[model samples]
Target: MSSVLFHSLRVKAIQPDTAEAVVVSFEVPQELREVFGFTQGQYLTLRKEIEGQDLRRSYSICAGVDDGELRVGVRKVKGGVFSNWINEHLQPGDTVNVMAPQGRFFVPIEAESKRHHVGIAGGSGITPILSIMKTVLAREPASRFTLIYGNRSLRSTMFKEEIEDLKDRYMTRLVLHHVFSDEHTDAPINMGLMDRGKIEAFLGTVVPAAGIDHAYICGPFQMNDEAEAALLAAGVPEEGVHVERFGIAQPAAGAGQVGAVVHEAKPGDAEQARITIIRDGLKREIQFYKDQPSILDCASAAGLEVPFSCTSGVCGTCRAKVMEGDVRMERNFALDRHEVAAGFVLTCQAHPMTERVVLSFDER
Candidate 1:
C-alpha cells in the first residue's frame, strides 16, 4: 500500500465543543499549506506516543474548504487512551504528528446548482457532516440544506453553536432538526433516537424524498443501516445516498449463522506465500505466513509502511488492489460490491489464499 507520511504540526488551540469533546486546531505553515489543503468531509490521521506506546487515530475535519482553518473535533471516548489524553493534556504549542487530509465522504459542489441536500448525523459523526454542510452552504448559494442531527442530549452535541450560527446566517436556505435520546421537548418529533421510524416520519413530513438531490448519512453502524434503508424505501436512489461508517458493531449472538459466510483458513491450508506489494511505483517482495495477523501486519513487519486507520476495516484507508493471485478477506465492512469485483481489498483484513500474491496500492 502507498505510504502516507505524517507532518509534525503545532497545536494552535483547543476549543471545547462539549463536556467530552474539543475542537483541535493546528497551525499549518505557509510551506505546507498546499499539502494540507483539503476538500470538505475529508479527515486527518494523527499519530502520537503515549507512555512509550505509539497510537494513531483518524478524526474528521470539521472546517469547510473555504473556512481557512485546519481543525478537527476529538470526542473523549470512555476507556479510550488517545481521546482521553487529548481531552485532558493536549494544549496550545504542543507538537503532534498529523497526516494530510484523506477521505471520500463528500460529493462535488457547484455554485450554480440549486439542489436540496440532506445530512443525517449522530453524535461525533457531525464532524464531517458539518464540513459538508458549511461548504455546500457557502459555495452553493442556490442550494438548500436540511440537517437531522441526533445526540444523547443537547449538552453532548458537538458544534452546537457553530450549527446554530449557520442556521442564522442561512435562514431561508437551511433547516435544522435536533433529536435527543435523553431530553424531552415540546415537539415529540424532536425527541427520541433517530431510528428508522423517526427518519421515515421526517422524510414523509418535512423533507420529501423525491425532491432530495443528495443525502449523507454518518453515524453508528445500526443507525447508518436504518437511515439508508428508510431513505431507499422512501424513493431515494441508491447512488444518491452516501453513508460513512466510523466503526462496526459487534454481531449479536448466533447472528453469523446466516448471510455471507467467510471461511477461515485451516492450519495447513497454505504454509507460506510470496507477497509482492507495489507502492509509489516501487515493488517489495516479502514472505508471508497464512496464520499471520494480516497481509498488512506482514508487510509492516517487513518494514513496509502503508496508509491505514481503524484496522478493524471500518475505514477504507488501507484499500489495495489484488493484481494477481487469490486472497480471502476475514471481515469487510468498507468496500462496496463494485470495488470488490474490481479486485480491491482492504489489506488489513485480507489474507493470502494462494502461494503467490501481488497487490498494488497505486491501483486504488
Candidate 2:
C-alpha cells in the first residue's frame, strides 16, 4: 500500500479550456487497473515534485467510468504551483503522479431505468457534472438531463461548446442554461448569476421540483451553499442532492501560522502514550507528534503507503480508525460528527494529540 509505487503514471494529453484551465488526461498503468476504476463524479489526487517541494492537488474526472480513459480537469488558480504548471507547461507524453479516483459525489444508476437528473455547477465545477450528465443520458435512454452552469462570461465558460453540442444531440432531453455574471445577452435569462430567485423560478416554471430524481451540485464554497439551500427549499429530498466540494484552498504561506500546545501524557499510559498498529498480523508502534505534519505524511515519509486523495481533508479517501491513540483533526468537510466520534480519523487531517497513535488501512 505504499504510495511510492502508485506515483509513476504518464501524462497522455493536456487539453486547454481557457487561458487558465487545462484538462490533463493520463494513461493509467495497466498494473493499477484495480485502483483506477471510478464512478462518474469521483476525483483524482495528483502529487508532484516542483521546485524541490512536494505539492498536492485534486481534480475531478471529466469522463464516465465506461470510457476507460482516466482524466481530470484542472483550473489554474493564482499562486497555485501544480495548477499553473498543468495549465502552462504540461504536455502530452509527460509524466504526472496521481492517486486513484476518490470522492463521495455520485450515486449508482440503475441498469434499466430512465431518470430525471438535474445538475448545477459554477465556473470550473462543471468537471464532475459533465461526466455524470453524459453517463446518465448515455446509459438510460429515456433519461433526461439538465445543466445550469454559471460563469463570468462566454469566453470563460469551461465546456461551453461541448455542452451546446450535447444539447443538439440529445434534442429536448438535455437542457442547458448558461448564466453569465459579467456579460449581457439578448435573452434575459442568461444575463445574470443563477441566484436563488432564478433557481426558484426555474423550478416553478420549467422543471417541477419534485420530479427531479437526482441533483448534483459543485462550485465555489458560497455557490455550493446557495445552490444546496435553494434545492432543499424547492422540495428536493436531502438525499437527492449530491455535493462535490473542492478541497478548501490553503491560504498564503504567511496568512496565519498554526499554533499548538501539547498536553501532558502519563508515562506508559496506553491511552496517552504509544499506540499499536496491527497490519498483516504484525504489530508496529507509532508515536504521535502534536505539531508535526499529518499522520499520513509521517507514514508516507516512513515508507508506509496509505491511500488518500485531497489531503486538505475534503475527501474521505484516507479514513481510518484510531485503534489506540487520541488525535485532533481540523477542517473536516467530508466526515460527519458521529463518524469522528466513532474513532474514525481522516488521516490526512489528523495530528497526534497524545503520544501513541495507531491506524490501519486494510479496507475495514
Residue pairs whose backbone atoms clash in candidate 2: 273-356, 274-356, 275-356
Q: What is the lDDT of residue 313 in candidate 1?
A: 80
Q: In model 2, which runs have C-alpha deviations exceeding 4 angstroms?
A: 4-7, 249-273, 276-283, 289-294, 297-303, 322-328, 336-344, 351-358
Candidate maximizing lDDT: 1
Indicate which candidate wins on TM-score: 1
Per-residue alpha-carbon lDDT of model 2 for 52-92, expressed as tens digits? 98776778898877777888888887777888888887889
Q: Cα deviation in Å at residue 351, candidate 2?
A: 5.0
Model 1 worst lDDT run, 10 consecutive residues: 257-266
TM of each candidate vs. truth: 0.93, 0.84
Q: Candidate 1's C-alpha lDDT?
A: 0.89
Question: Residue 132 lDDT in model 1?
Answer: 98
Of candidate 2, the 10-residue stretch with the lowest lDDT total is: 257-266
Go through the candidates in order and give the clash count of each.
0, 3
